[model samples]
Target: MESSSNSKAKPRSEVLKIMEGLAQELYAQIERGEEPVLEIPSRTLSNTVWDPKRRIVVLGPDKLKRRLLDMKESKRFMQTILMLKLIVSSIREGVYPTIRDLYYNGKHTITFRVPNVGAVRENTWDEQAESNAAIEDLEVGLNVLREEMGLSADVKGKVVGPIVVRSKGFEIDATRMGDTALGLPPNPDELDIVKIEASYVLVVEKDAIFQRLNREGYWNRENAILITARGMPDRATRKFVRRLNEDYKLPVYVLTDSDPYGYYIYSVYKSGSIKLSYESERLATPDAKFIGVTTSDIINYKISSDYVIAANERDIKRAEELVRYPWFQSEAWQKEINLFLKMKKKVEIEALSTHGLKFLHDYLLEKIHSGKWIE
Candidate 1:
């Protein structure tokens, strides 16, 4: 299967070549009697930088070297090499392995006698996190996505719209999915967007709302694409949204609850989180706007006090952090966040049901047509 139309993942042949090159470099180091070292861009928080120009978080120029000769780094260096071997094998054998599968495939115990001590045991990797970290190192070092390397992961995104996508030589039209939405593939980058006839894309935070809108023919009525990742979006969903915004120039609107968590989710879709800044260029849609169930909505839409939930300490803390983010510094966002803080209250998207089940349709229409959204 090929990568998505706009994905930066290298072709399979190129991915294989890159992996081969990496292995050859290590082999050459061994032949030359030099300590083999792998230089990877650091994924630390300190290395994550905000690119004002791009309006996205990105990795700064910081590198970490894992040297085989160093006692502290030796284990990680070996793990990286092991992961590279497993990934290369998978690519050549035409087998797709999930991250969990890779972890189990590489997990093993080693027992050896110490010079003056009894036998000691060590595991290749005790947890999936270690193997996942190794995979990420390979991804960043090789400049190729894991999806390009034939790795798979759980996909949570679903879509329904006036669009057509091709996966593995099979065409799937989003508009004709009946009562069900098209489930996004594990690697959305591999799905080729065949055709798009939508004016805009509406991204919902809740799956139930997406289903509600789809079943109610929201996309049909508005001539738009609708998508949801259930909650905080996965990488495939984020990348797909980015493609729609960047490749198709579709105006993307995010609808979420009025809480800090919801605001953070929208931020992830727009500017991306600092933890995964390296993937921001491909996954983040900087132009995406928030069509929220904002704190103001509680007052503006006459949402009953019974439906408004009081914010907890966690919500307060998250709101404070959001206020300081570079992207959230806009006057509109500041007002919304500050309002939420002052009100010490939050409301769910379903709170709109207080008016009527069909009120959500009108709310969405007003948000889009009246240009009532925060970027």
Candidate 2:
């Protein structure tokens, strides 16, 4: 039960140096006829602490030992070593690979043979999910993101705005792209925001809403950048939104359904998710405002009750849990969560269709101008 103050994380170069140091230490141990022991942070949730001040989850220095002599531990040790070699070697060669690429490329080296019996065994990392989990474990141990290690996930999400980007030997003017919105690049590390001439940033929960806005030329009319993560925002989308706020100094507003899940989506952008909370400092946008389709909006807009969906058991449970979380305990947020629980109902942004196809568009402009948002 110790804090993360024991040690600080390092940059990518230092991470590579630490891996090399570990490898060298193991080599020295073998040369001295001793068993090599690898010490790494335990990725167990019990060992993870949510730091309220920093607003991110961090690992304690509760190191677990893996010795080369143990049979069960040896299999994991071998897998870790192989993966480490792949990562470090790839970085050295200036080649970045996705987790899936690394899995297929390194899966063959993971096969093992039984002593004396000669039975060939395989699957140290049986599937891509296993490899992905291992990568997360490595991140927790190293206290750095995989992207920093010259690795990236398949990109998700799309953006359209008066923003210009220069990266990977190409320049793009998003506003001049006409109707086609830009798909977020896989390697966002190279993307340099050349210019952002938007009044504010709008982050929507659903792609359908994003498309509706885009098709109606909402960004053109409002002079705002529009973005969507499809459903749950990925690291790339979150980071991009953060940049729109931090780099461009634009106010960011989230538009989501009047449901618990939508609330959680807003929370993810503002406070970061629990799983990837270690990188919250870079991912979370604490300044983002929640401009929502709230419970009162249904009544205020006079949407018929027929379009309203009953809140399922799971929705209520999630809202209850979120209301107790430290990050969602603010008076405004608490009231919203409480109202949803009290009403026991939910409504999507699509319900704005009751008035017209473009009602939601007008709603956004009105909300922004009137400063009707919850932080």
Candidate 3:
């Protein structure tokens, strides 16, 4: 065996962290209208890792065990350059942005990058789950720094909002902007009660839901903004929620399904999602909540006629246990949970449309005339 200790290649983690920080400095230097003194190191394509698919060296210097050890710490970091190459290459070749967002199901994963500022923030980031930490933190940090050079997460944060694809075969989102529409007195930051207008809002989870309501003429009549997250809630959704809280003076009422996926959806909305753009975390983390999918709705609808989703044992157990959780004990959540338990079947807002034109008119009328519908 040869002595592979004299390798100069930085560990994937170290290299990524180093390059990312440099990239940001280079980026910031440019932003400050100064010439960027960037010296992107010339890392030899030493095959430290293997790649059967590309039939090429995923890592350099196949004999360099030292670099291999660095890779062991973070597989995604080592793959950053490769990931960037693939992404930029794809972009240059005109892959659709939405398609790019969904690109990591095969050889990689899509992740978002966020950076942690100051020294102590490292510990704060480390506390997050490992997989989440990698894709959402360090990897995200590196990617976002590069992305931030062009765009922003929000006007205030100056953080880069990018969907990253990790070489470790994954994806992440790194952004930190809240909806400006959900709060009172017309502004969330200012918290002005005077700007408060409506008492509640109904947030649907899908565009199909919104479109159905609109087609049925519920949108204009209901007088409540019927917006869809179009799947997972994005920055736009957060801002909308915030605006509801700040500007609209409306109690934002989420209307999602009774499934685990829906529960996670609600969680992401209220709390901030994880940031995955750093090696050891050089960024921020956000958390959100899911206030809808009340078990009570499942119970109230009388699951006798057209109600039947075989609840997995896990689903049954979770829905039962969720009711006991303190947060769900709020008057509304409690009521919703009870409804779900009683029926033993969930009522997706989408289902209401099956009742056709009558359901839309009734649901919206109920919403507008009664504050309870939203609250």
Best by TM-score: 1
Of candidates 3 and 2, the better by TM-score: 2
Q: Which candidate, 1 or 3, has the higher TM-score?
A: 1
TM-score of each: 0.94, 0.83, 0.44
Q: List clash counts for every candidate, in order.
A: 1, 0, 92
* Candidate 1 segments whose C-alpha is farther than 4 A from its true place: 1-5, 112-120
Lowest lDDT block of 10, candidate 1 = 1-10
The CA lDDT of each predicted structure is 0.91, 0.78, 0.40
Q: Score candidate 3 by TM-score against the native.
A: 0.44
Instruction: Give per-residue CA lDDT, model 2, range 1-375, as digits (tens).
Output: 111211222445776887677678889999999998777777666767777676556665688877778987876777777778888888788788888888987787434577887757667677777677667666666556677676868666788988887766688888886777899865454476677788999998988888888888999988999998888888878877876676667899999999989988998888786666566767788888998887777777787889999999999999999898768877888888888889888998998888887688788987788898887
Residue 356 displacement (Å), model 2: 3.1
